[model samples]
Target: MALRETDPAEVGGYRIEDRLGSGGMGVVYLARSASGRRLAVKVVHAQYADDDEFRTRFRREVAAARQVSGAFTAPVVDADADASRPWMATLYIPGEDLGTHVRRHGPLPPPQLRELAAGLAEAIRDIHRAGMVHRDLKPANVMLAEDGPRVIDFGISRATELAAADVLTQTGRVMGTPPFMSPEQFSSPQDVGPAADVFSLGSVVAYAATGHGPFDSPSPYETAVRVVDGDAELDGVPPELLPFVQFCLEKHPKSRPSPDELLHLLREGELPDPRPAAAPAPAADAPRAPRARRRRRLLLASALGALLLTAATALTVLAVDSEPAPSAGDLPAGWQEWHKKSKDPNVDEDPIDADGPFSRCAATGRSLVCAGDDVMATRFALADGSNTWARPIDDTPDELGSGDLGTVIAARGGRAYVYGADDRTEGDANPSRYTVQALDADTGKVIWKTVTGDGQEATEPNSEQGYSVAVPEGVVAVYGAKGQQYALLDADTGEVRWKRPLPDPDSRICLLRSAAGNAYLVCQKWTDDNVTGTSFTQLDPADGRPRWTVTVAKDQDVVGQADGRLVVLNTTGTRRTITLINAASHIVTTVRMSEPQPESATPTLLNGTLYVTFPSGSVRAVAPDSGRRLWESNSTVESPGLPIASASHLYLASPSGRLAALNVRTGAVEATLQGRDDGGTADSSAPGAPPTLVGDALYVPYGIRSVYTVDMHTLRA
Candidate 1:
């Protein structure tokens, strides 16, 4: 494939070398990164740039690709759905597509066929675990890499739970290759699920094995009709694989085996017999000759599957391991990998709904609490993922774009502070009454509840679009009245300690944050008429008096304060400067970052080191004082959350439930905990909840669905 004159020379800093191919949505180009790593970048077609619906679908495609990470899939490296010309970059897999290969080299041999089956199964498994379904799976979409097959192209893929609610399908649009589509896809496109991919896998395997699809016909309409009403033409399929292929090609989605079940069958060497069970009995008088021959064929198939599966052993461990050995140090006394939905046992209904979905968590001692729009504040043991109790603060659904989302703010002294809202009126335009509840961490009992509002009338706390809350010295702080007011409440009693209006209530934005047990009100305004810069006001916890006020540039964002110095990030032009302002002396020290950061990059200051995580899955640890790059490493987890640090490792979680542990000193990934398949949609655009690190135990929340715990020792690099 060669690049055309119309193609761009570069995309997102990746140098485009050659064109890989083109599709209805975009063109994929072979590119190279700054570090000389090869990549495949898909640039959306220009004609569809202005199409709002098309952009939405493209965003969904990037989300799906980022959610799925495994050996049998091309992991997403970078993407920008909001760009003028949206594009995504994935690791380059140099191999011909299955369709091209079969056409040039004819049908694959038994060994390669066996490998393809298992690889596709693994790829589908990973996608489903991320709560997505690759609605379009065909020969042209699968790459035959040297190690195994890699699933590519997520243009038409979508989350399973969104199937029924998909807007595109409402117009009766059917979007997949007819021969590879499942019956349910044709009969009920909105209800298709992971089983649909299994059906496509079966068709793909049949094509690879015999150079033709089982449901092939002259017209796509005829082929689709055959797929829905006719039996598969498995006449040419290898005898050893006939049973498995037939099982996958079942007309009913429910009858088709799941990806896990297919893998299990291959592993157990007990594929169903293709021969009819009503065959004349031969055991009584014929020495069971037919049964013996069938057993031999099954054994041969199993042997082939096992031999090909050897290449995927590492991937299997990374994807489906129930438990793993300790890698770096000793784990907690009884710690093990465990997962549980945060739903209350008494509540059989669905979790609360929200426009943007994510989770928040806090941990203290041996207890962890997580809350989200999907579920209420749920308490779990740090040693295991078992929840002792679950409490919902507000059952009413949050309005879209209302900033009414709730979450666990902090956990301290055997109590968890939860920030939530109670909707007093049905669909009222006025904002809901915000409430903060202090619950006993061990028993999930409400200790105290208080209602307060910051004069600023702000949005959700910890939201990227809004400001964040801080729990300092056993006191909880919040803003209200559009960021014009501030309040502090006692952690144990949930009683308002002090409330006050800010000196400048008309500031553009005001953040209630704290550092080193001291409460601070940060406000900033940079407008055409009034550029007030930014002000940091330290407030007295006892009397609501401003102890001191520090002013900096309007663009400087406070990351944290350390050793009586306020640390802020200043992005001016191409330089990312970390400025440290001494609280007492008012001395400022500026350290310019070595590399430019993306707009989506988030900086976290932990234990004297400033760690910056990007949307591309890259993490960099820098010396706060000197701006020296300590180390940099890229993990498989995409759209990672804020990182939590231990003595030796930095742990991060992805919205799809994947967790990665990087060595803090060397920046090498030391261990990875496999994600779980919760059979629900994952919002990849939202950052995941940071993991709670307590001793050698780690508790993590998977999007808005469930919480899991793992022993740090059980993770291997």
Candidate 2:
């Protein structure tokens, strides 16, 4: 039953203007304070207020809410949690709840998804920092206001002391809505922490994108069971968001992403706003001298002034018009094509051009390099697509070989690198031998041949037999059993200028810079048990000598470098934390999230923004400097390969061979291309390979032997 509106004269010293809404817990009334400030007052149900225990809980909730409220949250205006009827008031937020919005409109667009994720992550981070936890984070608890998202209703929230009290009371009682609850909340509520919120966030995001929870069931019991034991049905959920959601919903609480981490993941591509230094707290019991009294009055005035300022800012934001979509002609020119190798006969070949299989191709300055199951190193003219060279590099018999010969193939700087294993020999007992060949990018002529040796030799300590090479600024950095080794080489002549070998054989070398006459290497050594012990060192190209070294945990991966600081992600496959190390000062600042994201992907840093991908395929743009998430996405595409981003678009290649382009600024899908079939596997053969971008095109490959070069301008159309 709905609560009737009460006249302003009867309720406290405030004027009740209208009935806002009613829920099981309370009836919310729109009211005005003495200064005419709008507020939403929630008067508890009469029956609940009559219960002493419920009243105590309400009071605790109010305290907790006040302790953690911030810009991303609805701040408490006034509350009488100890009153006969127990009522609370918060700054009234004018907006639709995420649940209602999704139900009214189908699904939130990618831009809105990013905004929602960033806002919620910040809210949760603030709550966690205050030692409070919002265990009931759901779509209904989020308000999508014009300015930003506002998290509301901490009725079921728990703090240090209240958490213990609620645990005792909820020993046998269900404490949360089943569909949105984390596994820990149902299995062991007392043990639940910030990770519980991450699980709920995943559900909220799922609902926002598809109007259904990850584990939607016919009954509450079934839903709980599914959440605890079943795999989430990801039918309509974007692939990119899947990995993130999966990480959030990990059965282990410690594996979930923290709120700060989530924020970083969401805001992957923008500079973070600076966080104001925390104000010093006043002494608890200072003497009420004249100065103290005056200070109190000043504080009150300042708070009121801040409120007015916020109100004015809100009005200004509301006055702005909504943005419109770009027209068709606004898009760039050029035909876009995507190639997917398929096993299915019906779709294995391109319907338009059956002149053999659609080959994987990339364009150079004047030529196109292509490869396929029956071909390798085929060069074509970029102007007219006329063939200049076609060479068969793979000579192994098809039946005994792994289809296309080479993997980890790349072409750049007028050179091509290809990796392929030698054919099985008669009665051979050793693992396959691999080979690396450098070819002239234009003429398809072999420049240098390096036998990678047998897999046994490749596994030898300090052996450089089977290393993957990367040329950053003309310097070739190689990773092999012999550890991280690099040689400064002339880009055109392939002449070695200087060479150096890393100290640790098991060290994973992440090449950061090979330009500006210096190269930076992040070397991470893993213990036998898989714990990371990392260190950063700089080397001069002129004379390979270590400049300085700083120790770090190996579990972290280097994300970016800025302002002489290194940003690293502390990931444990189940949870993530961000650590910022000032290289010169050797000071480390660790920012832990309220929720743990276990399956968060490696962070991509572009410009000042860091893009983090989750196992759920959700991508988040964050600012490492300010520890803030800028954006998030709902239309994530799942691919084993990492998404590549330019200044304008984020490019993702689907396993089924579709290439999707999203606006980098807004996370909106600008264009999509269903790839031509060329008999490729549905899954990726090389999971760690990032999509390569050259000029205005992107090069990507699936399990099939063929690769593809897609026009970026056409993709955005």
Candidate 3:
């Protein structure tokens, strides 16, 4: 039943001023606390007064809200969960939800989207720190106030403790709005934690960007089905935000990015706003348009000049030449000394050499991992640069039509996982195929190989067609266009122990293992384009079976896990927001950044500090938890890789072959390494890899050829 304006004049010493809103669960009223602060108070429906289960859940929500209240969320002022009609109150935010804003003013501009992403990421980080998860996140719940986006509504939130309790709700009974449900939510809820919130953030961002959810279905049932079975409809999503959104909407939740990763992507300007709706085609013979022709010529010349200037600057940096190696006496303790010649023969003719030089190297236990043009792999070593053994892989050609060699390498469980795709023709229906190869970390022997589903392989490159792999809980989790698949293998023999297929092809998955020895599968759904919704499921690793499920947003990115809560980065790409979801209580809290930073920068979180690196080599560190900029520096040259951090410094590598190290605590440039000038040209046509750090060494691959190793201690000493 709908609530009437005169329903209640007072409740729990707080006089109700006016009716705010009404929903199936309860009615919200505008109220004032004893301290004179305005608040939004929600009272449960009379019919549910006898539902002990729901009352308990509501209590859990109240607890969660109190735990995670902060800059980005409406703080919980008071609550009477045990009252005849359970009631809860939160600070009243005087602003419009994103839905109302978009409805009233179409889609947000590009700058708004960037700001939204940054703000949302910080908010999510805060909630995660407090150990809560907001299971139900949507545009209607986000307030676009003057200060920033403020996330409200914690009616269906959960904490880690509540999530672990015995099932109080029926199985397969949907608990959230279908339009914003994650795939895992349909299959499992008890296990759904912070990652589930990320899926919701992605959906919310999609709705903000193009004024439509990633999944817009005819009916709630249909939406749920589509969310659990189809792809994100990303047609109207901006190209710049596409990759990041896609990563967030991966069918496998584990593969979804964390708030930090999404912040980085946003800062890097990787997510572009949707191009203005294509202008109507001109008439075939609409006069010989001389003015239009002149404008086009002028624009082309300006663009060319800018490109040339950029190229010239990059070349100038590369021409600085190599410097003599620093002596061992200048290094720190436990930092061994070593050096070696490039195993890559034909250095002069190498395609990577044409771009510039290799800047750094990394020693991972007994492996010396290096980066080269379009290639990165591991070589046998032992804490030093000395090669226990060397294994070489063919590099991709520097041509538009050439195949791309995998660039990211992660070594775990005695095997190295290489992420790459075989490039294809432009018009080819399937232009790229993502593959994961497991090689013996010690011998570089191919242990096993797995390709994405046939449907993914059949899709075109520009379409949803790639996979990401991560090792979680002793299992090789592979996320692809079709869904998440895993191969539990023997750590030593590489023999497959078990395999399981996820529920949806378009679901983004993230693997979260709780302290209770339970494994949760977080999955978010997507359409062909936008991130419409998210869902989470818990699976018993012993035998993959559905547990409980929770729904988050239409679009969101899982940022990180802390104290049992999942941090999520929510954005429409044009307007960023961060939300925290309590896996146990199903409560959500959101906060937005004051303004959007440039998209050219990527964000990173270290010891509570958020660092964003821009394409122009500028790096800014912000305190998302506190909503303040810790430091900003533009002195270092930018690179394609993510920022690498050590105990004392933050390092960034430029494609032009320079490694800049900054003091971590002070954000000061401590040293600069003018890497080897191999005279190699960069593959401007392809995506670049991020730098890798292992032990005291930094490994960087630039322009396509060669790998360089720089001693952090030596540089500092």
Which is the leading candidate under lDDT? 1
- Candidate 3, residues 275-311: lDDT per residue as tens digits? 2222223344332211122222122222221111111
Candidate 1: clashing residue pairs, number = 18
Estimate, for each residue in 26-99, the C-alpha lDDT of model 2 and write its tens digit: 77888888898989888887766655556666777787788876789998878887777788898899988898
Better of 1 and 3 by TM-score: 1
List candidate 2 segments past 4 Å from native: 1-363, 367-410, 418-436, 450-455, 459-466, 472-490, 495-499, 504-521, 525-532, 562-564, 574-576, 581-596, 600-602, 674-680, 683-703, 706-717
Model 3: residue 252 alpha-carbon error in angstroms: 30
Clashes (N, CA, C under 3 Å) per candidate:
18, 55, 129
User: Which runs in model 3 stand beyond 4 Å of their true positions?
Assistant: 1-363, 370-402, 419-435, 449-466, 479-491, 503-530, 536-550, 562-564, 571-576, 582-587, 685-688
TM-score of 2: 0.43
TM-score of each model, paired residue for residue:
0.52, 0.43, 0.45
Pick the TM-score winner: 1
lDDT scores of the candidates, listed in order: 0.65, 0.54, 0.54
For residue 250, model 1's alpha carbon misses the true position, in angstroms, by 44
Rank ordering of all candidates by lDDT, starting from the highest: 1, 2, 3
For candidate 3, report its TM-score.
0.45
